[model samples]
Target: MSPTLRSIVCGVLGLTLSAAGSTAAAAATTIAGEAAPACVQYTAGWRYTFVSNGCDTVQQVTVEYRDGTAVPCRTAAPGETVTFPGYGTSGNEVLGVVLCGTTPA
Candidate 1:
């Protein structure tokens, strides 16, 4: 990621963390509910990140990057795994995966 984008992302994350004060517990509960269809990064290297969907339902997710870019949303069946390429540049990293939606299996 470029230094500027990295700084912006860090700043945003910091602000989000600091702004959650008393709502942290509520936010955690909401997040947990929303994360039912979660996809996690199982392995990562310079070139790729492997994401796995361990939920009981089909999940749609997108791979976000540190450079403020993202891969197109993809659907993964329960217990399925997917691979996403990195930004392919020095200092750029995969931020994480975000759930887009879910469907019954």
Candidate 2:
């Protein structure tokens, strides 16, 4: 083939390969799933509301504190609310909550 035609074919092939690679990369990087549990902040602490969403009632919920301590899991019925009090000074505490029997993400 002529050099010009060869260059054009190579350029088109490169573009096509790059486009396909990018499409696959985009799909692999995408992160989409069901919504997370609803939570609200109150004066003393945080409240998490669990929904069954056609699943079993929330049997337990856990609260993890900033200092690597976690409160004992407590039973929470479907559509029930659980609270975790704030720690540390006015606004420096961190709390982590996880719900059992929750709908998967």
Q: RMSD per prediction, one decimal?
A: 12.2, 14.8
lDDT tens readout by residue for model 1, 1-105:
999999999999998987675355433322111232333545667787777888777776666677865354566788898887855757887666777642332
Local accuracy by lDDT, each model: 0.64, 0.48
Measured on C-alpha atoms, candidate 1 has an lDDT of: 0.64
Cα lDDT over the full model 2: 0.48
Please provide TM-scores, in order, for all candidate models, with all chains considered together.
0.54, 0.36
Q: 8-76, model 2: which lDDT tens digit per residue?
A: 999999999998987665445433333335542223333332222222444455544557533434455
Kindly give the stretch of ten consecutive residues in candidate 2 with the minimal lDDT sum: 46-55
Query: Where does model 2 exceed 4 Å of error?
Result: 1-56, 90-92, 99-105
Off by over 4 Å in 1: 1-39, 101-105
The clash tally of candidate 2 reads 0
